[model samples]
Target: MNVGSTSTGTDALAVLTRVSAGYGRNVPVVSGVDWALRRGEAWGVIGANGSGKTTLIRTLMGLLKPSEGECRVHRNIRFGYVKQRDGLHDLFPFTVREMVDMGRMRGRRLPSDRDDRMGQALETTGLVGIADMPVRELSGGQKQRVLIARALVSRPDVLVLDEPTNDMDVAGEQAILGLITRIRAETGCAVLMVSHLLHAVLQISEQLLIVHEGTVHTHARDEAVHKDLLSSRYGIPVTIRPGSGGGLSVEAIPGGGGGV
Candidate 1:
């Protein structure tokens, strides 16, 4: 699942030029940001809590306008988002398949195509067997997978996920990671994911962005480089060691005054 060596396609699908954003009239969470996402690239965003990682994603997704500077996505690019929480309501009483079908209504004008896409999406996410199950009855991992399936059902050019592996066990984490790898391999869509688990991000991301003090402190494709930069920024020594199931264990030095 190491995508560090993968090359992004020629065209830049999303660009942020000196983008700064915040709610109300408050100071921006991050400022002077400049970045680009090319087609078929998988980018990882990492930072401590309240480091504006969520704000940056919101700006990119057009949920919040920049207070200063600009943010732009390709005119032809369509986005699918998977939030940290599934936000499923019990009142709706939608089946798993019906829930996934909603993604197909993004911009489609034909109901037939939407139905076909939903079916394909369920199969793609390996949820075809339980397509009729109540969403509330599924396990946490299953629910997350269904959310991803819903995102993919739109066949968007860009997919954004916020903490996609949250609330899952190790096995479930692996399953989700495997699915992301397979999806990228099959669809070649651009992906931007926010993750707290550096090991998982290292497994699948081609590019890494570290946000700090309301700005992007580092960006690179090399995991080693990212590790070094992270350690330096936090004023601590971070050592990455091999862990079970080929994951990584990050050891941080004590007495480091680095802000989380």
Candidate 2:
């Protein structure tokens, strides 16, 4: 892999140059990646289970260190991260407002603008009425929204979501996806999201990244390259076609199962 240089983009919010990440000093789970996330852009990452998608995001978030190369964020840039809701402690006694308020920790003090941002985040996620409700009382979908609201409280320049809609049903998935769109539209926040919802990813992303065997394949959303790359990476006869709603859809070819 090329594992491009460390030269930053003119307006990039973050840049990854020849970056590699893993649990310890062992063989890296993801390596040789070169990417840049520009302001107001949305990038979607997809890969099969164990392909290191979460590792890559965590590395970007500074939650994990890269074993080699650089993962650089714009100086002083704020990042908001929303992980899968499954990781939330349902038994936590915090109310919705208190939970979202945690996002303010990144700042020195609760400035007026930051306070307004937190209130707006809760209102934007439709959690205002339930602001005092215990997080344990919320449904799965509601909890996911609360998580998103918490992330938004920082008014971060870059937002990263790892499998935000993992366990939701179709309606829940659509709602979350729609909420993501609204967030980007309103805040113009650069978004890096890892999702299993192929069609929704296709609809929202400006760029698509497919991770396979710890490597990365990137393509513009409108590019045709993904069809072959995805099929080869997944070891399946994957097909990409237009859906009735003018979005792309991916499916495995029937009876064409065993891959090349």
Candidate 3:
């Protein structure tokens, strides 16, 4: 695949050039990938299980070093990440306000505008109504929103979500997806989502990183939603068409032995 030159997309927030990143065994999960996260862009990273999706994101986050090429991020660009699983102790009863406050930068003295930022984050996330609610009592969708609010309080330039809808039921999944779309539109923060929600991803993302057979292909939305590319890859019939909000809609054709 043509991973592109390092010098391209100089205005992007981050760029990965010919990057090969993985762990142990002298083997890389992904290699020779060129990815650029540009300003005000929403990106979707998708692939089958263990197809090196996480490796790519970690490489970009500086959690892993590229064994081959270079990964670069713009200076002073803050990243807010919502991992698929949070490490917080569930036994501890934390309020919504307290939980979001945890995202504030720790220093000798807190930022003078901390309260204002917290309020804005809560408002942006629709958490103002439940700002004092106990986190343990929240529904799945509400919990996800709290996580997003926590991240937003930091005013990050890049927001990364690792499978934001992985375990949700249909309602919860759609809620989170809608919230994500709204957040991107309102905040204009660059969103990088690592998700299994393929259709939802296609609906909201402007750029796509499709990892297939150890190769990462960068695609525009139009190129990424090809029926042949998806149907053949997933071993099922798939449907594709234009969606509301100027994006694409995809569906799996039913009655096949294996699902899409």
Candidate 4:
């Protein structure tokens, strides 16, 4: 759960102490997860599809009641959530600007009609030119950018992104990742990214968290990920190598290649 934290002093934005979360009255999907996310840090969470990554994220975001222990965020802290692109309805009627305006709803102190923030978000996300366009007609990358804009409009202290580059082409994916990197540098906001893009995640994340079963394994930026552990958990031969972009790249041995 630790994002861009360094050995030196930095304030924590959120902390989870022996936490567990799941649907009401059901077995917990994730348990005993203890971690802290510090301000101005970037953390990447990776795991198999059903390994409770999403559930853990929901717990951290306070969208789900923790079945055990505690999940705490700093007082008055704001969060920005960017869901997977597939979650956006293609036929939704809202225009891009109007859609981005919806982000202001979560800010209790913000004026009800904070159009300025919406406008700034569009500009920041490079959607100003198309702000008036129908959301359904936008390209996949454009749609994802709109979602990012919505999240940014609130000036959140922490940004949570789930598969932000999903359904995008290579160019689109690179563009979005680059945008996120730039945003993190500019705003100094803690970023929590959950994705299957191991290379991309490693490139920008200061810390890596790998979830297996109901537990978590944390690694610092310089620590190596255990290939055998990943292979065992995923039932495939996972390997890591240096990427062209100066970060470690992860791949599965052929019999079928996929990330957990």
Candidate 5:
């Protein structure tokens, strides 16, 4: 486990030990990493742009090899990854049901229960009515739900979401975030999300992976998430105050680092 990590006594799904990940030996973006994805745990990864968040995720998912140290995923653990932005859209043109079916159709023979899995996922995501609709015409929030449904259909042990609500309006973002909570409650799968939406992430995640410079520190949410820590990572003056639904609101100061 990384420094400041809390032990919930749950089994670890994947573990990273002193990892340094990047393109090549000379281009390490993040270093000295120690983290774990534990069963039934949810972690929110946050940092400024280009500050090694993607590098870390890629390393963990085995898409990019780490230049140093080791990343181990326990045998039989499956990952369902949702990216910041997907390539599928109106121009590509696939029906919503077809899009989601791709989750279980990844070069494998169709199982007897495939339709049942698909129907359950679509219903869970509230896409039963739009199952036959063209994915190209869905709203931003609907598209996100489709992606999430696709991931869920595979029944992953770990669900990884990258900026799940990046470009939506406030209402849409909140709706998608709320949907995630509902899914977690129903499925009990572990979740790890990296998002720019700071306040919402802070409110939902039980643990925080604070990536800065070239390293990561894991902290229990209530123990270390504060304006000072976020300001240091973002290099700006920040103020955090109470917000609606008992969540904290983050504001960037216009001038410089001055207290509110």
Candidate 6:
């Protein structure tokens, strides 16, 4: 994968304008944020609790209407979304395969082709062996992978995830992160993920969007800038050290860069 170059089709994607949104009749949770998601770009949105991270994702999904600015997804664009919470209820009796197959049904009428796509998605997410497993029976990580597979089965041009690694162990987190990198390498689909895991986000994200006080404070791909902003925002003293292969390592400074 050419990490230095943006995806070839990036120019074809839509530009999100100065979008603002909030709950009904309440104050806006996000405002005056203008950003664009290019095809095959991987972006991470980081912020503290109540920082409107999930709200931003919801607005992108068209589940919430923007109260201020326009959000324009390009024509013919196809997208898949994974929410922080499992929207699927536990009482719903669906197997992993069945749930994944539903993704393909969203935009097509051909059942056979949909099934084929579902199979491919399962393979992509490494859930092929557990195709017959019940959704509720899978572990948290497995279930999250299934959700990702469900999103991929539709063959989206972009994938959006909110707090995808929220309730998982270290191994689970690593597995999901690996899957994300592999998927991007294989499919070249754009990814927009909202996560609080600063270290993990820094590892894979090509760009970072920092939201604070209902607005975007910074947007950049530089590792040093991201670490500095995160350290300041979270009150964690952060120091950047050079790593192997020209990467950077971030360490928290004792009793510094830490405060709310």
For 1-260, candidate 2 gives per-residue lDDT tens digits of: 22233445588877888998899667999999888788899999987778889988888877788888888776667788998888888766899988888887764666457778778998899998999999989988888899899889888888888888777777777788889999999999988889755776776788988788899878887773367777877768788777534556677788878522
Please write out the lDDT profile of model 6 over residues 1-260, one tens digit for every residue.
Answer: 00112223458465556888889879999998787778788888887778898888777767778888876666667788876546655787689988887787654464467667887899988899999988888888888988899889877888888888887877778788788888888989988888866656666688887777788755566743555676766546676666423445456676774533
Lowest summed lDDT across 10 adjacent residues in model 1 is found at 1-10
lDDT of 5 by residue, 1-260 (tens): 22112333348878888998887557689998988788878899887777788788888888878778878777667678887655556687788899899888653465568989999999998999999999989888899999999988888888898889888877877888888888888989888889766777776689988788887988888865577877887677787777545667667786775532
- Candidate 2 at 64: error in angstroms? 1.5
> Which residues of candidate 3, in runs, are more than 4 Å off?
1-9, 85-88, 106-110, 232-260
Residue pairs in steric clash, candidate 4?
A: 4-41, 4-42, 47-260, 48-260
Please give, for residues 194-247, the per-residue lDDT of candidate 4 as tens digits.
986677777679897777787877778566366776676556788877754555
Clashing pairs in 1: 30-214
How far residue 210's Cα lies from its native spot in candidate 4, in Å, is 0.8
- Candidate 5: lDDT over CA atoms? 0.80
Off by over 4 Å in 1: 1-10, 107-112, 223-227, 234-237, 255-260
**Superposed Cα deviation of residue 164, candidate 1 (Å):** 0.6
Ten consecutive residues with minimal summed lDDT in candidate 4?
1-10
lDDT of 3 by residue, 75-123 (tens): 6576888876454446888999999998887434566799999999899
- Which segments of model 5 are wrong by more than 4 Å? 1-10, 106-111, 243-246, 257-260
Distance from true position, residue 42, model 4, in Å? 0.5
- The C-alpha RMSD in Å for every predicted model, in order, reads 5.4, 3.4, 4.1, 4.3, 4.3, 5.9
TM-score of model number 5: 0.89
Clash number for every model?
1, 0, 0, 4, 0, 8
| lDDT over C-alpha atoms for residue 62 of model 4 | 78
Task: Kindly report the root-mean-square deviation of model 4 from the true structure over all alpha carbons.
Answer: 4.3
TM-scores, each model vs. reference: 0.88, 0.89, 0.84, 0.88, 0.89, 0.84
lDDT of 2: 0.81
